[model samples]
Target: MPTNVSNLPPVRRWVPAPVTKEDIDWADLTFVDLAKAKTPEGRAEQVRLARDATHRQGFFYVINHGLDKAIVDRMIDIAALAFDDVSEEEKIRYRARIKETGEYLGYKLPQYWHIANGVKDRIEHYNFPRDVSRREHPNVLRPFLPEVQRIVEFTHRGVLNEVQKLLSLGLELPENTLPDLHPFDETNHSFWRFMLYNPRSQEEEDKTDNVWMKGHADHTSFTAIWSQPVTALQIKDWDGQWRYVRHVENALVVNCGDTTEYLSGGYYKSAVHRVIKPPSDQDGYRRLGLYYFHYMADDVRIAPLLDSPVVQREGVNKFIVGVPPVQETWRKNRASTYGVTQLERAEDGTEYEVVNGVRVTHYN
Candidate 1:
């Protein structure tokens, strides 16, 4: 008989779950309530939880964070309708044109990304940039799930702001420390993504290893994912073991990214995670996900937090330095990672590759 997850211990809170390796213990991920974070004590406690989670696990579930079930459900419904209802030709009408020019602020059809194992990721997605200026782009103005775009845009900004507050609190810096870098101005580099992963047949699932997405980190400062009832999402624990991440009703999953890890001088970590085939029942149906990638403005420089005590003790030598602006990094990273060949080389000819597009590397 297959395992029934619902009968297990509290799925919302941290509880014991069997792991693949005998030496690996189940991770103790926390669920922080943002509503209570209104008070100083509540905020402090939440910050403590966040601090510990980032330092150790780099991912956690959040509750009472302002996004309601209606919003999440509507987003999901709209995403499904867009991908399932809209004809492929219609979607292609808005298909990303800027990728050729080294921009990723539009629609991407399935199979645009390939796994290291030569398997193409079966996903279709539409990306919306937070920068108001990009609103005039043909892809943005084109009618490909307009309502879905609106709701996601509204929800993502609010969530990023709140998460930034929590991050600042956890870092022991002024609440605006991170927010100051991420403004919703015309130069915004943030983006919201609506994604649908096509389902696999039982025969296909059985023959495959089921690693639909390779483990990687987000390149932005923060990433927020709405919880869906799928069991494919897995995160690497401190012990280097991969375990399924549980979905709690009405909770959003948040994870740190490479930019944040750099900013914090390694005090916080960027999680390594991936998606595989879910359990038997879910494997038969399409999986939909909503994601928000938060970033500083194009002009904001990437640098370590000089005032952070954590950085002071750890020493700046261990952290990244002299990084370019956010947009520069974003363009170069996206182009290199996705094989968008247009802007692969800088004018001066430094060879760079975006390892997973979230991590950066350069070679002479």
Candidate 2:
């Protein structure tokens, strides 16, 4: 959930190690062709690629996902209209009050956010829930609601479902294993976001030491971003180096998140990533992005699904079941990031835990 309010507490500045030729070790990320994945002839290779991508980089590109071109185009067109044509007043008319719904839906105007570099990010976003029928308030852009809703539903039913099934196969679990955790029949709390990063003048960019967004891991299972020509997204490498994620035509970039990492018994990683100015050639353009975040129902308790082959061999990590509901974790992460003061952290203390032999954030 996002708001126009500012309340982020002080944190350390983000100064990544300088980029060097040797530090830049990898060439390109693993790309999976969904069309190939669905074919009997290519299924085995597809699964192998999926397994390597998830376990090694925790991020990959998907092509031939079977989304109708018209739907994809419409989604992008509507996003541009929302950001460019719609007035600020119009956006405010539909702004979501998180305090009221206890959920992250609605317009989130740009606000100051201290990143690892200790500079506020210059970005704004509009978040729409996956199920339009469950929306508590009407969107001001009502005229386009039909198309918008269709796109969200299509992404979920078309792309998300297939990716989940493919990953399940790669994990050696039942085809429905991951999908069962996220049933379409339920009121899924997943959301689609339309975001814009305002272009910065050279002087303005020079004045700040921060990147567009501080490096952080998504808290969902996996995040999907529509490929756009503008390139500004970056992902941290296994060796703690930052590298650009090149944009691929008609491909959706997918990255594992915290929940997936936990559910996979730490076999998969929650890739740390951030946005920054595109390479010099693309710097003049304002960056527009579309993202779909997929997650299990809020009430579902998340932990290692103990029966997975990886868990069976290596055992479960620190995140045990029945600690807190998925929604609680979602709320806590959002509240902490946005400076929302209404909710306080539960008295339960934090814990230092190891995953893949490295310490990471964990709470019991």
Candidate 3:
């Protein structure tokens, strides 16, 4: 049974992933099994694997991280309930003040952003920053905050921290090198999000070519997406071709984000990903996503770790002076993502906006 069972609404039919299509070529992403890191040899091997995953694909799957299955199911169930049980009129009361404050700590309606040709995104989500209690939620999710918090805490400590350390070791830096910059005790934009991608009509789907979200990188550091069976998630491969991320029960599809590119001096590039409509076997089902976004401390400098042997050898690719702090970058990028301010598109056909000398990309 999931957590907060007594308070949960009647369980809805949980949709599972369909049989993976045989003709589709899935990305051969590296797998980092957390349970394998119990021994020194095991940890060393994981470090190599982590480096490979970061260096090339920039996205990988993590398994055996010890997050209980029931807890994950509870979070998923609560996501569906939070979005469906609340009325649109009432949901706005708790919406994030993105245009005003650039903080992503509440519900977001799908009708806010224009995807392409004025077709708004077909997704709704609730963001719970590390200090989730800062924002008010609807009654449907009020009782499940603690359960959701568990997901955030575990993802931060049990997952992100370990992965950070492993990557730092791969850089030949101290084990705590990267993790120290992202202290959970302090506040940052790191958030746990419950996302629901609503199904689109055939006309709308055809108009947009079935892309739910556009192909772009994340603005934060690391993102851990709890893998559901849905086959809509895809990542741009090394050859710049999009490939579906294979589904693994109870695994997390973790990826690097932009801030990490600056911190590691470009040793790790941010993963570019997008969501599209599911295959024929899984079409018309609402896609549920649980994500933990990790960001560095706001006061931390967004520069290369020169102490890293790999970085020193490779040289810093993004060591510009007068770089803005993490807060401004996070806020500006967050605020501009949906064009809270004026937005522009490049002649080259990519949606782009600049903030603090950074080019933020969006889908058309």
Candidate 4:
């Protein structure tokens, strides 16, 4: 941490630019109240709500998470400066080596990634791993690392831990061992992301039907996306229709990750979602996003807790034959993908691949 953080720029909270004026179709999502989740009686209420959320949509809104809005504002404020005030060359120095080493730490440049069918990908994001000291970041991020660390820890312990418990209780578990399975302070793939999606040209949009990202699922225990006012995010529903995920003020949109689906024995399969060009009304301005990508521990296996009554009730134990650690699975997928050499979908447009001896599926 910087000495006293005195040299850091004064906090100038970021004000949201005007939201889209377009009348867009939005999906109805269940909201899990964290304030209620903290209480004994309310915990059960949240468990049911969360179960309903994970079961169908694999997505939901998390509200009253007790993460002070001001702190969030500060984080975004600092992130804005980090992106806007620095040189691309300097930022690129810390870019993640996802292709080379299967690592997603530090900065990732816009348009650096390749997309299929001649579509140009546009994004610049920074990923700060759970262990902040694991890699160096841009100089501008140094002073705020302490507070950023606090925000990460708080989101894990205060916000995510509550939701994890709800999911755990929903499974009829005797104890909330989910915390032990996904510890906050451990060496995990969990990371905070500050991202920017720049506007695309009309010609580019025409080529891809305004699709900014292809269908994909995250390799995390759970993913927390700090809601931003841009109608670009959409999820593939059960009927295979694309539905927009609405933006809720002060709510973190949470989704079940692939790893969690494996752990739950398909009780809640990971949802597939993607980004598209901002609606015409919102396309004029760039979209800035804040997120906490929560991955399982390095050594957590991809298998259900058979002891759980729900898993047993689900059916005959037909999970991974020889389960592998999630870290290896994540590493294989990360290293293989990212425009180097397209790994043909295992079958019928799927991200099914055998990694670490487990059959993992994440559509891409």
In TM-score terms, which candidate is top?
3
By the TM-score metric, which is better: model 3 or model 4? 3
Q: CA lDDT of 328 in candidate 2?
A: 51
- TM-score for each predicted model, relative to the true structure: 0.79, 0.80, 0.92, 0.90
Superior candidate under TM-score, 1 versus 2: 2
Q: What is the Å distance of residue 57 in model 3 from its true position?
A: 1.4
> Per lDDT, what order, best first?
3, 4, 2, 1
lDDT tens digits, residue span 1-364, model 1: 1123244222122121222232322356788788888898898888888888888988998888665565566556555555666677767776766545555566687767654334566777877766434554343234434445555565555666776777777777888888888777766667777787787554544444676776666677888888777667888888878878876776888888877887887888888787888675554666777887877777766667879776778666334434444545654455445532222445654333434223343211
- By summed lDDT, the worst window of 10 consecutive residues in model 1 runs over 10-19
State the lDDT of candidate 4 residue by residue for 93-189, as single tens digits. Answer: 8777777767667777777655555776888888887777777878878877878787787777777877888888888885466777878756566
Backbone clashes in model 3, listed as residue pairs: none
TM-score comparison, 2 vs 3, better candidate: 3
Score candidate 4 by TM-score against the native.
0.90
Candidate 1's C-alpha runs over 4 A off are 1-27, 131-150, 201-208, 317-325, 339-364
The Cα local distance difference test for each model comes to 0.66, 0.67, 0.81, 0.75
Model 4 scores what on Cα lDDT? 0.75
Off by over 4 Å in 3: 1-13, 319-321, 339-348
